[model samples]
Target: MGICSIKQMTTRKLLVLSTIHQISVLLLSDALTVSETSPDAPNSDDTTSINHPRNLATEALYINQNFRRMVLKRNEEPFKYDNPRLPFDEGDTDADSCVAYKYRSWYLGRQADGTEVRLICRTEHDGVTTGPNGETQMLTIKAFNEWDSRMASGVDWRSKLDTQKGAVLATELQNNSCKLAKWTLQALLAGSDQIKF
Candidate 1:
């Protein structure tokens, strides 16, 4: 019986060792190479630097208010900006009520040298805002890893807003991953004192 008990103890020791080995292997393989927020990702401060083009904002407001078909230009030349214009109408309500708005195409992408490049962008709202008591409704965005390197090199992101808006998102698409794009815009929008209606 003593010998049998000794054998059992040996087996238990082997089992525990195997378990530890397996866990260690898993941890080593699963070790994250990138930082928690992606090395290339834009942080909150990055978003504050982006502001909707004044012309684009005015166009959106005009469209939303006038209901006329007009092509919005980026006004910032070479930045090919074209997006669906919308506006906020408080009607007879106080001018302060004019906080409602919507984003038409705020993200875009492109391809270069077999790798994709993405652009972080967004349009503005002309209507009343919903979040804080007072805040500006602005478009927010971030570049995709696929296109991030190129975009960070100083290219105006909002070059095209209408039909080519998809290009902005497409240029930066890395195997169809949307996490970076979403995070970028969300971070940019986080600064608002109030959310748009």
Candidate 2:
């Protein structure tokens, strides 16, 4: 859209468009921050703005899609719904033939400097979606937490030598005890396909 000024455009949409055009730009936002719609639309950058405290299932869905290369399915013309440019950026995930999932992972995190900053994040995807051929495709994502907080080998977490004989999951669980608890609680409340998880 040459009509829209760069300052007036949503960075998320701009990145998607840029990726399509093979342009280089830093992505400072989550991939699925919103419904891939218009910048001025009420829900343009909307993140699960409903009455819930938070939800992240949809972000997991996009991650799963990217991993599965289901994003390639978006190259199909019929799938090109929201983007003004196509043949490059993956198109919208159609809700008519599948579940239209939404997400919310807006939160506050402390930086290395101990300053709290807002960050967009990812979470979960609860159910299955149908493909164009009516094939049932299940989206299961395990965004596992590694124990290291971007820390060096010796400091924040125990050295590899120290934990060499311990169970890996146990060490991670110890370092991310509260994070694991929160993730478990979210998965339980979401009633997601644990078998899929």
Candidate 3:
């Protein structure tokens, strides 16, 4: 098999594995929800306000459950890559390629803290020519909020700034890097920033 063919196979396998794992997690979560088998308690005659924490909790439970389903669906979609023909075979010449792909989703709501968290994940694939074979490297970036006991105690929200700031900074870096790398190459070859030019 040619170098590009081998690389294509490896990428296809990665995509399939990622998709299957995502689906399995969704199915498992669904099964857990249904198998609990706890009968719902009868509604009480006393009705206060819908804004109560208990009512909010019940609503949040359903929203979160549905959010997970949406996440799985989005992740399964094929992301744009620098090499549009990627995961494609290059007949021979040991091609040199660089590809970057990213996926992002955001949720805005109060969860103990007033600030909302943004979820993001990005993956980069870089392949270089080495003699008769092609060597490709894949790197992934994942970020989520972490609980900080110290911040939870302080009155000022700035105490938790580092954590939130870190996530934002990482996301910005990835976005900028991918844009720069893709554009730089296009400029070198086409003498312009436009991909088609």
Residue-level lDDT of model 1, residues 31-56, one tens digit each, is 31211233343332443342222322
Stretches of model 2 off by over 4 angstroms after superposition: 1-140, 145-166, 193-197
| TM-scores of all predicted structures | 0.18, 0.28, 0.18
| Candidate 3 lDDT tens digits, 1-197 | 45578788999999999999998777544331210111221133444644332443344445534543333333343434465553445664575333343343546566676767665434332211123344332222122211222322212225535657664444333433543354355333322212210
Worst-scoring 10-residue span by lDDT in model 2: 33-42
- How do the residues 1-197 of candidate 2 rate in per-residue lDDT, one tens digit apiece? 36776666787688788786663223222222211121221221355543111223344335545553443345444332233232223565442333223344544788899987765433344345565788655443434322222331212334453566355444444544554565566655444444232
If ranked by lDDT, best first, what sequence of candidates would result? 2, 3, 1
TM-score of candidate 2 on Cα atoms, chains taken together: 0.28
Q: Show the colliding residue pairs in model 2.
A: 56-124, 57-124
Q: In model 1, how large is the Cα lDDT of residue 148?
A: 32
Instruction: Give stretches of model 1 more than 4 Å off.
Output: 1-4, 34-197
lDDT of each: 0.38, 0.41, 0.39
Going through the candidates in order, what is the number of backbone clashes in each? 36, 2, 0
Q: For candidate 3, what is the lDDT?
A: 0.39
